[model samples]
Target: MRRVAMMRATFPDALVTGHEPLIPAMTNDPKDRHVLAAAVRADAAVIVTTNLKDFPSAALAPYDIDAVSPDDFLLNQLELNRIATLTCVVDMAHARNRPPVRPVELLDRFSVIAPQFAEEAKAQILNQSEPSPWLIHQRREID
Candidate 1:
């Protein structure tokens, strides 16, 4: 929720998308289809979820949506950390935390591992929703 709220505050004009019907099988209230429908509508390139098997590749192939894990998503964020400008701190954190993650260690570990997976994961995170208004506003600001 922090990330979602951040996007709202940071990129208010960003286009964020979500599955409308929300597949019935995947939910208690179950709709006609799952997130796939929404992703298809939005033409998403990646869909981040732990349930990779739940969303079969063949099913998503038509829409060109690639299912990715949270690890992959975090890695993508790390890779794209340049935009957020946390390179030095993130690198230091990663270097400090090597393996056998404890809670505190995990945070530092993610900082380092995230960048490696950025190329593949960045698209999924952005595709999770349309650009937020803030993001759109930032674009205008940049222009």
Candidate 2:
């Protein structure tokens, strides 16, 4: 099972559930389709998954399940957790097994992939008005 650390911390009151392994269809099994179906049955609005192609939004339209990528899911989590999206980006960049980024250069790096989101992330970081790395990492989220 995925740790989903952010979700656990932010949504302490949320009713999070996961299904046991079930045999899926030959073409559909092992895809996000099974998870999406379960979420649909549970009346969930969003289906968070790393495999975006497997959980194409078109297939989930009937169930109103909007498939979101891991990055997007993490950004949404940051917004809800009161942790600046930029801070999360920086953390993600550093946490990655590859190269680490300078905290000051976060916007420069993230803008390449998501320019608008980078701006929003910067705004959230600047407006928070403090430079505590620990505070940036540890947020007390409200549901």
Q: CA lDDT, every prediction?
A: 0.52, 0.57
Model 2: per-residue Cα lDDT over 1-143, one tens digit each: 34577767768855435433322421233555557646755678887665677766557676666877655765676668645554565666556454655543566565665555566665665556774675455333200
User: Model 2: clashing residue pairs?
Assistant: none
**Residue-wise C-alpha lDDT for candidate 1, range 1-143, written one tens digit per residue:** 98699779978854545655444323211232456666666677888776667677767766667888866765665567734533333343445444532323334344454544543333433343666454454332221
The model with the greatest lDDT is: 2
Model 2: per-residue Cα lDDT at residue 39: 70
- Model 1 stretches astray by more than 4 angstroms: 1-4, 13-34, 74-143
Give TM per candidate. Answer: 0.43, 0.43
